[model samples]
Target: MTPTAVDASIQRVARFGATERRLHTIHASAFVVMFLTGLVLYVPTLAQVFSNRPVVKGIHLVAAAAWLTALALVAVLGDRRALRRTRREIERFDADDLRWLRRRTPSPQGRLNAGQKVHAILQAALALLFTVSGTLLWLSERNTDLRLPGTIALHDWSMILAGVLVAGHVWIALSPDKLPALRGILRGTVPAGWAASHHPKWQAPPAGSAQRAPRAGPVRLVAAAVVVASGLLVTAAFTGLAFT
Candidate 1:
């Protein structure tokens, strides 16, 4: 009674639920506003063209607030179970995930490949840094004591790193091979065949046929976590100097 290949190719599988899409939509929309406004604020040449610096600055602040608000709203109203599961998936990496990073041909070990997981981690960390540094910079304008040299550099560097990641993400999403994934995120479903080919580990299983996949050693994982945390702490300490 197994389905034929043709049947699988045309079958639609749920790739992302409604809550996920909504969160992504809000995040993306806010990011666009922030990035564009940030460009004007960061680039001297663009700032010259846009003479109304006050308005631009206001818009940039508003966008940053919206970004923070979006996360809060999602936390209060979004599917808690789904969000938790996604967080777990993005945080853990298995042997397949490690291989996925070095050899691109093989299917990722899960719904999110290793690279995607890494990108998600970086984005979250950078977003936190951006918020912290941006807030300090905004307040520093009024309270000279809050002014910190490292704060501005952290904010600007975060934006640059995030920009590069976003660019690569967009390029991959737009590529023909990856278009199905992009469409899945947008529409919440994808051809089962495509999912099978791209993420075999996540192929829609028959009812009551689910099982857990094996994971890799935790040494590297712990080391990576410590490295990221150390970097963040160093930057945080450097930025906090102005306040102290």
Candidate 2:
């Protein structure tokens, strides 16, 4: 069936719960802030515009902590069933997914296609690398005489890798075919037809039971606000330290 036809036959489906959506928002926001602040600190030309190294470093660290915390919280409290399903799909790619990757077949995917799964896996690994190298870098700052030989290089290279992966991720996400998935992230629902066409194996919730609206509970809002405020406070405090 054509994508449009498939979508037209299905009802609006809820793909993400409120907690999952909140975690995603927090993670994405923190990554953007970290990427920007890290870029400014790393590039000489960019650093010239914002010469407060301490403040920039502080922002980067705070963003990293927030992003890691969001990931941890999602792991602990997000949809367990969805997480398990995604993990299984990622671990064993279906034949159709491989064929799709090789351009030998045209078929809809399950909850996540092979490409998406691979991306998630790589990003997760990179996050770990960044965390370790970054911690070493921070410690080296306090004890220069005990600095590890390759700690700085590892951290620098990991940042470069992350930038490249994120660029590809953004490009793919913005492509026409992936727009529906992007909309699902923002709205927590996609037209049944679109879901069926893109993710054929995905089972929809029972009729009349789909959550068509995005949840913006007060607690979620407050938590997000606190994260942003904490990032700002970290930046200000470090900037003050630089002046002292």
Candidate 3:
């Protein structure tokens, strides 16, 4: 085969497996829950706009905390595997993909465009902000001695911004042309053709076969289990073990 034909064939081999898709779906769902719950909790004025203010607020706060825990687990525990896979795909972006991503015209594969990449990074950063702000808010409200200036303001504003950003993320997720990307999340399987079109280099192998530096084992798992169990116990102390 000629050099150009060989390059084309090489590009067709990269694809993400069902595992990554499952992770992405879980992340997306968790973020959506966190965002909506945060909205209901933070915007008391919306109580007038919507009904059952206090109940909604409670639900929102609880969901946001749960999602935060879940996301933290995903990041700390799953990052090693996820980052490796995403990097392989992202690194393979060539001039054509870049141009297609930036162009006004729609793409055939509708892979995550450049905007999605930026938003993903921003979402990660915002998750950090939510963690810090939330902890501070919780502390300030509980302890009389712990005085944090702008704690209330920061929490409120950060949540508001996160809400807006999440809306954008959802819009992108629901975009008409990106059905395949959405399906990848829901069905936990991107067809081989879909992966070939979107991520040319991710088709490296059938996942789990990639060799990389050894990572810490099950530390994140134990940590997550402890945290979730503790949080549940504490919550049960007041709310009767409401797992919802």
The numbered model that scores best in TM-score is: 1
Off by over 4 Å in 3: 1-19, 49-54, 72-79, 87-112, 191-224, 233-244
Tens digits of per-residue lDDT for model 3, 71-158? 5555555545656656554445555556766784544332445566556667667767777876666555557666688776877787
In the range 4-112, model 2's lDDT, one tens digit per residue, is 2223466577666555566668867887897798889889999999988777876787667667656655554455566666567678777888887888376667767
Q: Which candidate ranks first by lDDT, i.e. highest?
A: 1
Candidate 1 lDDT over 145-240, as tens digits, reads 999889988998999998999999899889999988887788776666677777778756432222222232475446445555654554444334
Q: Pick the winner on TM-score between candidates 1 and 2.
A: 1
Tally clashes: model 1.
0
Question: Candidate 1 overall Cα lDDT vs. reference?
Answer: 0.73
Instruction: Assess candidate 2 and give its TM-score to the true structure.
Output: 0.76
Extract clashing residue pairs from model 2. Answer: 6-193, 7-193
TM-score each candidate: 0.79, 0.76, 0.64
